[model samples]
Target: MTSHKRKTGRRRAVIGGLSALGITGAAVVTATLLAPAGAASAVAAWPQAKGSKPVPASIEFSGTYDGKLQRHYGTGALGSDGQDESQKPLFVLKDGAVLKNVVIGAPAADGVHCLGSCTLQNVWWENVGEDAATFKGTSASSVYAVHGGGAKSASDKVFQFNGAGKLVVNKFQVSDFGKLVRSCGNCKKQYPRTIVINDVDITAPGTSIVGVNANYGDTASLRNVRVHGDPKKKIKPCVRFTGNNTGKEPKEIGTGPDGTTCRYSAGDLSYD
Candidate 1:
């Protein structure tokens, strides 16, 4: 826990300079700051919570809400962490909302639901329920940004994109998960989606990093991705799919960078 606090303090020191530039700017710049001088071989450690809180119902809010790094889990009606698709989220964010410094513990329910453009900063998930978070904003201009967080134990996806516009994930980490970010494969109201993943650390026992629907014109741009403990390189950086709106499972067409749907070069990825 002391080590976690020290790492967080270092990150916060960098954030103090970048926060004024807003979410996107902070995301872009923080990517470079993650690997500081003399610490290139260091792996990010998972955070330890200050305490725990059980949420009986969803907490919906706008503007900004900081959890102070306390572990928040589900209870009562939201206690189950099963793979049920209808589970409710622990937190709901309105448009332009910002949620930060939150640690979601086990039985996390649906984790979080963003109703519109939102920023999730330093929000870690110890055990992902339905997902770590779901982006549901239905506007071409809406941007869902996730920065400085980590998730583990996700049976399936860590982030589900069921909305439109662009979703940016930066300076994040994930381990023992399924897909990191999956654009909706069977949403009835499908729209062209954009995903930007930068400076993310992915640990093995995981699946693809970004899965996009090529048929829906979804595009994923990956940069500075670091994969650990996968010597065989089984973890794919990007996967393309032929998606649909018929409520059926989407078919995966291909994987890797194509310079079209999946964007990135070999120089953008590193194996650690």
Candidate 2:
């Protein structure tokens, strides 16, 4: 497959997920605004639309799909909110799958459930009923350029990692939410999860970039993350680590204007 590039004036063109097949430097994602419900701060970093290629035919849009072999999801959706909507991950991926060019308009309990391993690119969520993505039970996954917000049903966290081996998220742009990323308690020593978040841009206020909880045994590395909101009302220690932490203290860069630090390292948890 040949990957073509489309230059639109000064705007950056975003390619599709077909690049996963073998092609590279084609897939792209455009930033969109959050809901108008005073949910998030405004960010005028990127445009809302970018050009890209069509999705592969190996994908489908069923309410419930079990990815025991290999599959892909790249379509509008089916059903309504709480009624088999496309945004909901009624599909189960126990093996592996790829999700691209997905626009979830309705709200659902869980966005995408990765039981095994998965890759998500250019996926957007408009109004989520719950967490955007969840990794649980020894799952390993990677996500890139995921944009969306507006937790109408619940003040849900965007990404939740309960128990997984390795999870990597990059270029994640969150318009607003309760918390950006979370590492669940009850971390198993056998699993020993490692989470790496890079280049995360958020506009959430009065909430921790990472939820404060017993994040045990997991090693988290956050680099080049930027949080925009009221520094006075912002969540302190953007990253929190509690419990039997045997891993290295998280590393972070930049801080909010109100002496808002980034992580809960032993000596670097607080600033003013």
Candidate 3:
């Protein structure tokens, strides 16, 4: 069969079954907001979405371990917050994976976060939901791990030395209150180390969802995309570019959508 045929086929992969070296739900997870299902943070007992791309059929992983492992979960959650919706994300990275209609019902921190390394050629996130994909990470020593509360897709930045991976977001969409994707963490100035986004829609009016964040002064690109709100109710700007709201304007990235586009390209966008 051809590559396209395989991609359009079913998904089958090997997930988690054993624990990490010293990482635990109570130890690693200090406190956080939310995250959609199938989040990388929940890799231990990573729950497969009812309608996500199957592992063996379409997925792979690269971390401290070798192959995928399936773990047992309770309430399907992450972070220190007990308000995580049950929207587990089915993370995978294989040669060919086909994702059909799927609905992740819950708040999430991130859908996928590849560390060791991964490369996916034919894949999809068609109809992916972000009930409440939050993008706020707390500091733990100096490593700056990932946060909870909010859905997360493949980051927009990556490196072979740090995290070299290929993720394609095709026919994706969010439904709840959260962000589409972001490159953040407990790092200096919160940089987008490894991640990316492609072809997506955020026609959700329940809450706003951010697409990508080019932290660390990196240039995150958003090619063919569109975001809008309900006709009856007035919503804020589709994009919120924040900065050191010093009442100053962003002198970078197209002058920024006023101060809203937190460009921070120039300096502090504080509100002093």
Count of backbone collisions in candidate 2: 3
Q: By TM-score, who's the top model here? A: 1
Mark the regions of model 3 whose C-alpha exceeds 4 Å error after superposition: 1-112, 118-168, 185-196, 206-215, 232-272
Q: TM-scores of the models, in the given order?
A: 0.89, 0.53, 0.35
Candidate 1 on 1-272: residue-level lDDT in tens?
99989877777655553343234465645554656412344557878899998999999999999999999999998998878999999999999999999999989999999999999999999999989999999999999999888999999999999999989887789999999999999999999999988667899999899999999899998866889999999999999999999999999999989999999999888897
Cα lDDT tens digits, model 3, 30-77, are 211122112232112223544321222112343322222222111234
lDDT value, residue 228 of candidate 1: 93
Worst 10 residues of 3 by lDDT: 10-19
lDDT agreement of model 3 with the native: 0.27
Q: How much is the lDDT of residue 42 in candidate 2?
A: 38
Candidate 1 vs candidate 2: the TM-score winner is 1
In terms of lDDT, the poorest run of 10 residues in model 1 is 15-24
The candidate that achieves the highest lDDT relative to the unseen native structure: 1
